[model samples]
Target chain A: MILPYYIIIPLLAAFLISLIAGKKDNWAVILSVIATTALLVLSLFSFISMKDETVTYSMSAWSLPYGIVLVQDALTSFILVMVSIISFTSLIFSIQYIRHLSMDWKYYSLFMLLVTGMNGVIITGDFFNLYVFMEIALFSAFALVAYGSRAEEFEAAFKYAVMGSVSSFLILAGIAVTYSATSTLTMAKVAEVLPTNDQKVIFWIGALFMAGFGLKAAAMPFHAWLPDAHSSAPAPISSMLSGVLIKALGIYVLIRIFYNVFNAPEIFTKIFLVLGTISIIIGVFLAIGQWDMKRLLAYHSISQIGYILLGMGIATPLGILGAVFHLFNHAIFKSLLFYNAGSVEMALGTRDLRKMGNLMKILPTTSQTSLIASLSISGIPPFNGFFSKLIIIIAALQAGLPWYAVFAIIGSLLTLASFMKVQRYGFKGETTVESVENKVGWRMNTAMIILAVLCIATSLMVVPGIQEVTLDPVVKVIADKTEYIQLVLGGMNGN
Target chain B: MQQNDGMTLIVKTVTRISVWMILLYGIYIIFHGHLSPGGGFAGGVIIALALLNVLLAFGRKFTSEWLNISFLHDLESASATLFLVIGILGISLGGAFLANFMNKGELFALLSAGTILTLNIFIGIKVGMSLFLVVWVLAGSKIVKGE
Candidate 1:
């Protein structure tokens, strides 16, 4: 029952904001806050209810595999929680961040639409529905990237939109091929029938899906547009893009389709591993040279995503667990880092680390929170990043892939060095320019503080009881492929 | 009367006569969408084209009086909301979201296909308004060039 609200609330709020917000800018902010808060509560409730079993809702009372359905399993619930938390915080941060920009109401409306699209992507059970939601997210993100309307922003948005549309076309092509092969659009039914199909055709579909989703995920060879798009957008939007958009639209869908629908083959696993390794090494090498603060963080996003992919590539129970955990942790810390970059830009009017010095003296809250996020991202102990990285390495070794574990460690070290440059150039040195006092808004500070706390708290999920309650079900769903088919198809037959 | 703002008098005169015909055709297509080849989107685009013809013939100042961009924006939002509300009505009526609750009616009547007609009407209004606003914004931005 609550599944529909996940999409309806944000959608309704977007339209309502558009209708009334022209009269008063504050109404957009207030209404968005209320809408996001409701989403957070609903997602938490859904997550709790979906702990033990899967809940499927058939649209228009049509039987499963026929009507558009929304299925909430442990994996969907986990992502729902991640998206709502980050979006709610980003909205709070934007309350202050967007005030200086023109057309704030339009910003809010598009932001809600983006949320609605992401939620739709996460919850929809059909491939065509997924494509529709993906476009909704992509189009809104394109507009949001160009929200500043600078020449550079426009250029970046154009590049992103072109690449995004190309990827979408590839996905549609893949779906066309898939439907032709299996004669069905439902994911579980497709998965069930896919095994008996032609191996050559299956291979082609897998290749297309990998390329399509890899571009969206910003994997190594397909990562040209991310640095620009991530750096050019306003800070909160940047955080949202890096934090959840790439995950929900790119990596999560790839994992769901490949793991659940296609049943991970050895060849695809090898492809994932190679792509993951390349992105990890290349992304960091690119980051270390960047002078701009947000650009560096953007590059690091590619690198961290490489870690998650590597974990997925390992394809062991522990590996999947590590990957899922890293996905959640990255959402928290990466958004926090982007928020820090935003605060720096807000105060100093520049993103070049070359121009910044000793911000810890003035912006105590911002600096400390940034330090926490940086350490967490760099895999320091007692932070969430460390545990997830540890699990991935151990899982890889357990899967008899010591070399891959070595590559994971190498990526972590490079991440540490790159962030060290950030700490030294952006926060540690004495003020180079005459120090100007700028008052950081309480709303912005509060959002950062909340994420910082989450960075520490999420580490507790490594505990036995917590892991069982929160992550185990998701791991089971992914690792045990037959159960997924049985659950979805069985529900349909019962109906 | 030599009007400097608009196009030639012949184009203006022709547009004045054909615009109403185009609008009438658009409405016909929208209302009969349940039984016809052209539905809400095509009809809505036709309606937008009619308005665009008016703008082309009469110029900005003349059309600005009736087709205000902000009003079009509001209408787009309102129609979109109305669409969602209709979907919600299906849920309230004990069906799934977007379930066809209204009577199927006789094969091809104007009053047939309860929700489809209403939905088509909403989509036509929303699409027409959105296209109009897009054109207006693009034209308006072009006029402000040297800023």
Candidate 2:
């Protein structure tokens, strides 16, 4: 019953903000903060309550496979908690970040709508419903990207919109093909019927889904729009887009469909492996040369996603666990890094690394938190990122795929090099230009500090008991295809 | 003859007569959406088109006099809130979210389909007001640039 309110709360807040915030910008901030905080508490409560069981709520009491259903399995709950945390922090950060912008109310409204879309994507149990929610997230993101109304922002938004619509069409085509083959739009039912379908047709549908979701995830060949779109958007928006949007809407669905829905076929695994390796190498090499701060981070997003995909491609228990854990860690540290970048931009009014120097002197909080994030992202020891990457590497070796392990290691090294460049040019030199002496806002510092602490705290999930309670269920949901099928369709068979 | 900002006298007069008919037809489509093909989205677009007709017939000056932008904005938000409230109502009645709580009247009745009628009306109003606001803002921007 609480499942729908996850979506309804943000949506209602969006409308209310639009109605009242035009004359009073503070109302918009207050409403959005309250809404996101509520969502965080709700998601945490739902996660605890449904720890070991799956809960399915059918819309309109039309029964499974007929009406839309909201399913809260282990995987959905895990992602829900991750998304709510990141979105709440980003909303809090936006309260002060958007103060000087025109149409501030609209920014809050679109931000809430984006959260609604992502939550809707996570909980939906139907294929078409997933597409609808994906559109919601995508459309809001497009608007948010263009919110700055600069020439570069508009160009980036246009490119993103065009490419995104193509991906949507591909996803729609894949959905149509799946319905024609399986005669059902429900995810669990599709999984149930998929094994009986023709292998060739299923393979073709897999290819379509890979291309579509890969585009959304900004994988190697399909990643032209990410750097521009991420770098050009406003800072808080950049955090949201880079932090959780790509994971929730793209990689999360891809993993769900490939592993749970299609049972992780050999050919698909091979494709994922190859794509993951290419994205890792290309993304790192491309990132090493950029001087623009956000663009560089945007490229690293591609590289980090490659690591997660490689982990998934290994197709083992440890591999799945590592991938899910890495996904969670990346959401935290990456958003922390973006928030750090936003603080720097707010204080200095520039994103160019060549022009920034000696930031450790004035902006102590920004520099320290960014250093933590940079180390975390680069997989330094004792941080959450290191454990996940080490697990993925070990899983790859255990799976007898040493070459993928080698690439993962190399990607981490290159990630370290790129961040070192960011630190050297952006924070460790003499003041390149006159320091603005602009004070960082308390709200922005608070959000970044919280996330920086989380980057270290989340590493505790590696403990056996915590891992059993948290990551084990998500891993089981992805690893055991039969569990998903039984959970969604077994009720009909009275099993 | 002097030139006006909008269309000619004949076009304005015809638009004035036809817009009300379009509005009525849109309302009919919305109310009968549960029994027929047209529903909230299609009917809402029709209503938006009728408002657009009014905008085209009368210039910005005339339209701005009565069709306040902020009022339309508020209407859009209110209607959206109304639709969400209807969904929440289902939860309070010991059912799932959006569980269709009301009793179904007889077939072919105007009040059939528990929450669908109320939902359609809200959607119609939301879509109509939002579209009108979009057009007004776009037109206002052009005027600003022209001046």
Candidate 3:
């Protein structure tokens, strides 16, 4: 009962708010907060209740493969926590950020809609249902990106929409082919009936999904639209898009479908590994060259996502654990990083690194949090990023992939260089422009500070004892897809 | 109105009928998916085409008024909500995500076809509505030239 409400409440709120948004902005903002807050609480409860349990709910009381299904395992619970936290923080950020906009109502309404779609994607059990929710998320995101209607924003939104639509079509085509081949739509049913040998049809379908999702994930070859989209979106939106949207919509679906549904082959793992490596190396190099703050961070998002994908693709115990842990860490630090960037832009009226300097004295909270996020991302000790990267490196070395470890280290060093440049040019220098104005909003500082705290607090999950209880089961779900099918069928039988 | 309005109406009618044909064919594929080929997504594209045709033929204002862009927005949100709600039913019943066919009453009948049909329709509405809305907005006068 609570499971469905996690998705439905947000959707309903988005609708109701949009209907009345024209009349009152305050109402929309309040409703949006209430919706996301409810989700945060519900997801937290689901995490606690399902610690040792796997629960499945059939839609409309219909039976399996015949009726739509929603499943909540340890993995879903973990992702649910990530989604709600990021969304809640971003909504709070939006409260102040949207005050100046002429279309404040549209902004809040679309934000709620995007959250609704993301939550739907995370919780739904069916494959085609996944595609539908993907559309919801993408459509709302497109509209949100264009809400400002500036020339650059419009151009960016158009490019993002076209690429997104093509991906959607590819995904739809893949689903069509898969349905033809397996004669089933339920993810578990496909897994059950899937042939052992590699079918050409399945290979094509897999490629299509990878391309479709890869574009969304902003992986190396398919990542052209990301910098433009992220940089052009409003500050709070950029935070959410970079923080959790790509991971939930892109990497999460890739892992869920390929690993669990298609039972990905060795070849697929190799493909993912190569793409992850390229994204890390290329994204970091490109980020180092950028003068714009958001564009640089956008490039880093691609790099960090690569690390997550690399850990998961390695498919070793330590690797999978590292991947999941890194995902959580990335969500925290990346969102914090974006908030800091937003604050700098808000204060200085520019995101160009060359135009700004000496922000340490002017905006202490923003500067400090940005430093923490930079250190965390650059894998400094005591930060959560260090442990996950270390685990991934060790896993790579153990798997006899020494080159991957080398790339990971190199990426870390390059990231440090880029962030150090940021510190020098933006925060630590005396070349501050006299014309540069600074007005630090309480809302901006508060949002960045909270995420900065979350960045450090989440590091405790890396502790061995804590890992055993919280992260281990979720990793286990990925390691054994067969258990997923068996559990669902068994639960159905018993129910 | 005038002859120009009559001509425009004729064009829209032709486009609308063609879109319906495509949509109906897509639905045929979705229903026959279990034993033969095609499924929710293929059916969805067809449905989207029908809506797209309406948007294209009727022009932005008429389509927005007829489809009610705001109402379509609500429908789109509701479809996704419904999709998730349906999936949660499996979890509440103590099963996995999308774990359908619990009772196994029968396999071939229209009502007996199970969750596949329901999933198909939900996806159809979601895709159709989203795609149409996007096309409508892009083609609409709301899009400023420089912007």
Regarding TM-score, does 1 or 3 come out ahead? 1
Candidate 1 has which clashing residue pairs, if any? Answer: none
For candidate 1, the per-residue lDDT at B74 reads 88
lDDT of 1 by residue, A61-142 (tens): 7787568888788899999999999999999999888886674799999999999999999998899999999999999999
Residue-level lDDT for A495 in candidate 2:
19
What 10-residue stretch in candidate 3 chain A is worst by lDDT? A429-438
TM-score of each: 0.97, 0.97, 0.82
lDDT of 1 by residue, B9-121 (tens): 88988998999999999999899899988888888999999999988888888888756777888889999999889888888884677778888899877889878899999
Task: Between candidates 2 and 3, name the one with more favorable lDDT.
Answer: 2
Ranking by DockQ: 1, 2, 3
Worst 10 residues of 1 chain A by lDDT: A429-438
Residues A1-495 of candidate 3 have per-residue lDDT tens digits of: 566676678877776676566578889988898889999999998887778577876766667868777778888899889989988988887777667446467787788779878888888788898889889899999988887778899889999999999989989998898888888887777777766535877688889999999988999999999999999898889888998889999988888888777776777888888999999999999999999999999999999999988987898878889999999899989888888887788778889888778787788898999999999999998888888889999999999999999999999999999999888887776666544354667877788888889878888987889888789988988888556777676676666
lDDT of 1 at A359: 86
Deviation in Å, model 2, residue A101 alpha carbon: 2.7
